[model samples]
Target: MASVHPRVPESGIMSRPRPRHLAPVALLIVSALTLVGCGSDDESSEPPVASATEAEQETPGPDDEPTEPEDDTSLADFLRSAKVDDALVNRLGEVGDANGYGLGEGVETSLEERQQLATVQVGTCRDVAVGHRTWEGIQASDVSSGGTEEQAAAMADFLREEFCPHVAPYKEAPLPKQSLGGPEEDAKGGRGLASPVSWWDTRYRRVSWSEECAAQTGQPIGDPVAYRLSDDAVVCATVPPAEQLKKHLISVDVVFAEPVGEERAQDAALSLLPIDAVAEDETEGTNPDWSYLEGGCLNLNIQSQDLEDVVAGLKENAEPWAHAVHYSDGATADGAVGPYTGEVKQVSLSTGRNEPTDSGDLTC
Candidate 1:
């Protein structure tokens, strides 16, 4: 399932990758929820969606898994409640009642990462909130049912009524059918825009991002920053330090993807920041002891000395990158690794996240 809204195609964003295959988020794959319910109005449209994978695989078994809350009823009842105040204390205490199954890279605190956290039995309120909202709105419709234009019309309609008005404060405000972003690209790079600014992600404003260019440059951003969602797959940010440090460096970008999930993004970027903590911290005990991987940290720290060099190289240069190069062994073209035909949907170098759509129009 693609992550974009059923009506929109995924060719909104694109990223130019460097050689050596170091960038983590090579491909942005959003498994979109099936929004247009099946059958008819008689039956409840909501089918059981995959909350996440079963914990038996990635997580440690009974021997290594934690055993805190043996009783499952109390926990479920507590989470489903409108009032969790009294149970809050007990809830925090009972967090690890089950084993930490399938939490390999761990869960991400932001909405972007909730996609991976859904796999576990235990989760944070934020985790539950984000995942629930995303999957709950799954509207699955047959592509042929509403011709592409018809789908685009439906999408435009949805944005107009349910999604657009809230787009005012965004960098790219007015989302007309003619275009979703700014002006058209000119010979001398006149006016510009990529896609319509999205509000689906902003429904929950917990994410933190800057309004302008927040590169790692110590100087100032000379350009206006623009970002777009690949339907439901990206969250871009023009962050601060990135902007502050933009002078001496080339460029620094980050990407979060499946399997390893969102927490990895936080972990990856954390080491780059000046501070040791963030409002949304990494997963508890998420980093393993990979102390022996040459210069690689269990947390996957990029060389502190080389950060500026890498960023400088990225910003000052331009080269096409292919995400398929980073795939693990055994992944296939038709299977896990595929002949990736998705479109590059979003690019926010500030926060280093990119979302792609599978519309088959990508330059890659």
Candidate 2:
């Protein structure tokens, strides 16, 4: 019974990704919800503060750039308020009105909670011109516990009837495994969900250069939804059970392509971590994950839960060009020596004689 509110700093609140997969307790009300930095529900909360390419561009001369559009307060308000009705007609209307899109007549919206599903759809013409952006894309969840059969069936129905019909014509109904969020646990039979993780709290880039090559070459980048569906998405890896760590070092060997010096490697590893999680500093209440990168070899100690998950994600998302990566979390080994067979013979160097020993042969 709590609403997701942005956790802001004292100075101001900056838009960040919505924690759609947030655990219930994480949805508890914070101090106040502000419209100043809030973004639409579909938008990632972390709006990019600055762009590298933009910085490199020389300041636009007075004649080079047109007058920038003025801030639309009402439109901003609508984006900030981010509300949905039972039918979701208002939501659809608001989006269409804001973006000048159309929802064909006779669209039905029956299922209420199905809006949270993660999906990819063809965006506006502008989106296509730049790159195919995720239209009305929701955050995909990793914490879902697969809802009841009834809930699953209803979601399937919604996908077949509403989503596939109107949103994505080429997309098929998402299997239960693909459902982003899941059923609420009853006290009698369910375990409580874990605290929310802020992995998805990332800056959203409006324009994409992914399809730049295709656009330049006059080639199709294929269906946007299909492309996204087939794309190799790296998700958080499942942690092994405690028993799996019987006699293994909970470590990982990461080899960078070019040998980045220890200092640079350490810094790069540190940058991948969240602000709250500690690395070098061992202050009070500090949960640190150690990494020592030498000669392009990053020997990591994946002790903390956050660090373990992060390493798992790295393994999952590793590019083909990366040097090498090996995990030892759930690794096992055998102690017995090699099985060998050999004939036993005694050779006397002084006499230059070879004689068969009492031991006929040896086998191990």
lDDT (CA) for every model shown? 0.23, 0.22
Model 1 C-alpha lDDT per residue in residues 1-364, reported as the tens digit of each score: 1211110121212121111111122122121111211222224334555434654355666688575865323223322332323233232222211211112112213222222222111212221223221111111111222223343244334333433232222122232232233323222221111111232222212122332212111111111122332223233322111222321212233323232333443443433332222322111111112111111011121222222323333233321211111111111001111122221111112212122335411111
Tens digit of per-residue lDDT, candidate 2, span 231-314: 221111111112222111121112232333434433333333322233322101110111011111112221123433323322
- Residue 98, model 1, lDDT: 20
List runs of model 1 lying over 4 Å from the truth. 1-86, 98-235, 238-339, 348-364
Per-prediction TM-score? 0.20, 0.22
Candidate 2, residue 76: how far the Cα is off, in Å: 12
Deviating ranges (above 4 Å) for candidate 2: 1-146, 164-267, 271-364
Best by lDDT: 1
Q: Model 2: clashing residue pairs?
A: 15-45, 16-45, 16-46, 17-45, 17-46
Q: Determine the backbone clash count of candidate 1.
A: 41
